[model samples]
Target: MNFSGKIEYWEQSTNGTWSLFAVNPSDNFSVYNFCGKFGSCNLNDNKLPCKCLPGFMPHVPQKWYSGDFSDGCTKNLMSCGDTFLNLKMMNIGRKPEQSHQVGNETECKELCLKNCDCSYTYDEKSCLIWTQELVNLQEEYVEGYNLSIRVAISDIEPTVQNCEPCGTNMIPYPLSTSSNCGDPMYFSFNCNTTSGQVSFKALGGTYRVASIYQNTSKFFIQVMDVGSLRLNQSLPFNLTTPRNSSSNVSSRVTDDVEIVWEPPLEPLCNLPADCKD
Candidate 1:
């Protein structure tokens, strides 16, 4: 019988239970890459079942909006200091072209990072890496492996040139323009060479940098007189400390608020006076 333009056959087993299955052209979701590469199929989403993965944008917005995801999604060109966007609870379809046995997640990540061809990595029982475009990605009811996809740093946030001293305030570690300058993870600060002004990037707008105190692990950001700043009360655009650092970050608002960012003290104490035994 045909229902909703779909041909189906009801087959009864010996137990007297009948199963209805599609005969001719089945549902679009039944086929792999139904939503195209770098796209995911959401069975729960009736209105728009297809969406690009995080760190990706629809290749063709016009076609994507028209219920055609054939063009799929695309990512920006990545550089050496690129970071990963962790996609959790993913169905990550297809066998990995490259696989390896690793001791831990860090080892797994390092292996993928070394190879420019490695686009994504998964470290479950072992390390799994993929070089080609990801396809047939699905999000089932249950949780799945965590997949780390390499993405450009600029895509994650707004970046500016590294500043030793912007205007009057000194920029510290982990706040550089390029991968070679400082820890790229903390490259969230922007330096304006023309005006000699440094700004802290926020979701809504940029905040003028006031001062940085390495001893107290704090920095200050003031609202720019002519700029817009939309701050989230919950997060308030806090700087994330590097993973290896042992400092516990804390922030508070004052008439002039100071933010905390502490890296390993050894690097800062290299000067003769500071390093005196």
Candidate 2:
């Protein structure tokens, strides 16, 4: 059932072995610390986890001593002049209620500065600032992204909530990733969610992103290319794996995502008859 190296072919007439190796491995560069999970804690738990962000002090250090990081390593929310200090390449975190991404260190700071709700950052790539209490904090496993939350600044970005992307010459992509329906291309955000951010009702539709929003109120969605999307139509599409193909996805959205299709796996691209003209 398994190959030894590279899979050359799969034929019913003959049995052959196939093996695979990953050319790009992120595992070689992983750094984990319990303090990062504590949010306030540094690398070692030995130090007091109650330390506040730079330019601020703890609201109640005694409570944090009792394993209550929920006190949120308090900071001076009233501070006006405080800006972000970029810890280069440091691993920051993603907020559950907030949406953001990593951009240039200066842009990350500016992004937070634009919004009074945004305050600080811990890393250049994975920046983290705080306006509210930093709770349920955990060490982010994926290549962390940076975000300056808020200290006390006016709206930074051109958008109202500082929600729109701040930097990147070609338009920075959102971390909320998914594949483009019908095209088999992965998409993070397009015209849809951008519209939704302004008006909650604008985006929830037959599109896969809307499909997820309809079921889960959490509002985290990225339409993937795992299904055939019938434009302007609402119909249940079944995802099936080919006879021996490992790619497959279940129709039920709640179940694990099926690896419905692969690019090279499909027959060599022959244009649909209508496109030939």
lDDT (10s digit) by residue, model 2, range 1-277 = 2243322433342355543433222121222222222243322111122233333344556655565444444444555655442221124443543335677566556655665545455454654455544433322223533334443322122112112321110111111232312222223234332212211111223332211211222222222333432222122222333122121222223222221222212222354631322
Q: How much lDDT does candidate 1 score?
A: 0.58
List candidate 1 segments past 4 Å from native: 1-7, 10-26, 78-81, 117-125, 140-143, 158-277
Candidate 2 matches the true fold with a TM-score of 0.29
Q: How many residue pairs clash in each candidate?
A: 0, 30
List candidate 2 segments past 4 Å from native. Answer: 1-39, 43-50, 88-93, 96-108, 119-133, 136-142, 145-277
What TM-score goes with each of the models? 0.48, 0.29
Model 1: how far is 270 from its true place, Å?
Answer: 29
Q: Compared to the true structure, candidate 1 yields what TM-score?
A: 0.48
